[model samples]
Target: MPNLTEPKLISGNANRTLAKAVARRMSMHRGMSVGLVDARVERFNDQEIFVEVFENVRGEDMFIIQPTSNPANDNLMELLIISDALRRSSAARITAVIPYFGYARQDRRTKARTPITAKLVANMIAEAGIERILTMDLHAAQIQGFFDIPVDNLYASPIFSLDIMHNFRSQMDNLMIVSPDVGGVARARELAQRIGAPLAIVDKRREKPGEIAEMTVIGDVTGKTCIIVDDICDTAGTLCKAAEVLIGAGATEVHSYITHGVLSGPAVGRIQNSVMKSLVITDSIEATDAVKATSNIRIVPTAPMFAQAILNIWNGTSVSSLFDHETLTPIYEGMYSAA
Candidate 1:
């Protein structure tokens, strides 16, 4: 039997801010003494990750909110070690709430002599004693199959659609959702259909990673407000180039709403100099000062959304309602007050 009825959240160094936010959300509920598990994740002088669980977690459900974002290696290690400690301490179940799963891009090998790192990471997590996984907007949906445990991969469409409705309340008729590439059409199409907007595609050729050799627009974007939607934006090369293509095709302006902003290298500079009106990303990845300083880059808070999902999962309620735009208003709008 489980030690506790409610779940306890544990955070890692990868994104402590987000973990804190999740804790805060849980603290607001009534009859729910949900709070962070008393634990600490520190390091040795040799840069080794160490974790210690202070409080009794024996038979308690544990949720670790750690996104394997930048410095992914260290964060991944932290998660594995924390799970190991919890397992040893006799936690009932451990669910990894990794919003931005690192190495997800390496779900498969495009060339010979390359390893499928995503599969390997999944294996490592399973081996570390995690019972399940909860994540959002995985780069590839198929990555869920890599895990033998139950994986509840959430969608950001609910959050993204709400934001779009709020920001473009009046311009809904003129908006056109665009997939930066063919691979992202399904994601973009979901938003387009919800808001009753047209769909467009950016046909681009990638010779190698971080470089888009040639590009063209496949649908009519003329006189429309083009909004590019994608899962991951690492180098921002593809994002910036796709925005430029939309403008050349007579788009009124270009905007983007990517799930994970893994903005690396000159990504910030590229987005700033590009003709894009704005780039809206979720709080899945903590924004640095450069990202926060940009006038055109906006961050949508996912704390409320994630908090709701956590609540549902803990109660064994249906989280499927969170996948729809029409069904998830009160949660995102802060309807659940202090209880």
Candidate 2:
């Protein structure tokens, strides 16, 4: 049997900073000398991935923290290789802690002969012998159904809610939560309900990938500070255009709270020139140098939440309770104080 009480954590090259932060928080919360396992992920001259685990993992509960972000193929392959290595070493109960699930946008085939890459990725992970999965704020909730293993999909809403309350408490009455598209109305509505604000939607027509043809506001955002919410911001074309439409409709200020900041291509440039007041994103994907240099871009740490979730899973506690902000606020505050 595996030692379920003391879980071993291993991280790949993907999002090392976030992984370290999560490990630190786990050590603080559990009051143990929890640390990341020693590992080396290297590549050959021909671009073949090689992963070596230094410590013995036999009969230990193993968790690999690797988000499939930039260089998605490389990071994902690294994760699979690491899992196979751990499984071959007789590690018990392997869980892949993927903070940001890449290729999640292709949950279904919208066009003829298109492939559902999300489902394919799920199958790949399962075939690699991973017994459990832990991810946050998937592009579509339905993607969870693709996985056969036990998956604990965590949410970023609680963290965003706390930050909004702390920073925008005085402006709550005049605040309006806006969804960048109809698909995201549910997410925006939940956040709006938490802050006691009205919800608005940006009705947009996508002519093709990475391009927005038309955009119109569904509800009144006139003279109110609008906060656009969404799961991912890749290339940022839609978010920037939505901010323009909101500003034109008399919104006092426009801000965005996105879960994954896949700021590829000209995303940073667009945000720099857009009417948006600020763009707040979680540390699900590691930020690039351009993102760091952008004046209006801010990153909220997600380590505390991931830390708590890992602890809960190890202790066999209720994971859903972490979604309730009212219940988890004190716990987070305590963790901060301990740090």
Candidate No. with top lDDT? 2
Residue 231 of model 1, lDDT score: 91
In terms of lDDT, the poorest run of 10 residues in model 2 is: 330-339
lDDT, candidate 2, at 263: 93
Deviation of model 2 at 47, angstroms? 0.9
After superposition, candidate 2 runs with Cα above 4 Å error: 1-5, 334-339
The TM-score measured for candidate 1 stands at 0.95
**Root-mean-square deviation (CA) per prediction:** 2.8, 2.2
Candidate 1 local lDDT, 1-339, one digit each (tens) = 422467789999888788888878777754455667778899899999989989998888889999999999999999999999999999888989998999999999888999999999999999999998989999998999999998888888777888887888778889999998899989999988887889999988988876778998998999999999999988898899889889999999899999998898999999999999999998899899899998999988787778778778877888777887556777665532222
Per-residue lDDT for 298 in model 1? 90
- What lDDT does the true structure give each of the candidates? 0.87, 0.91
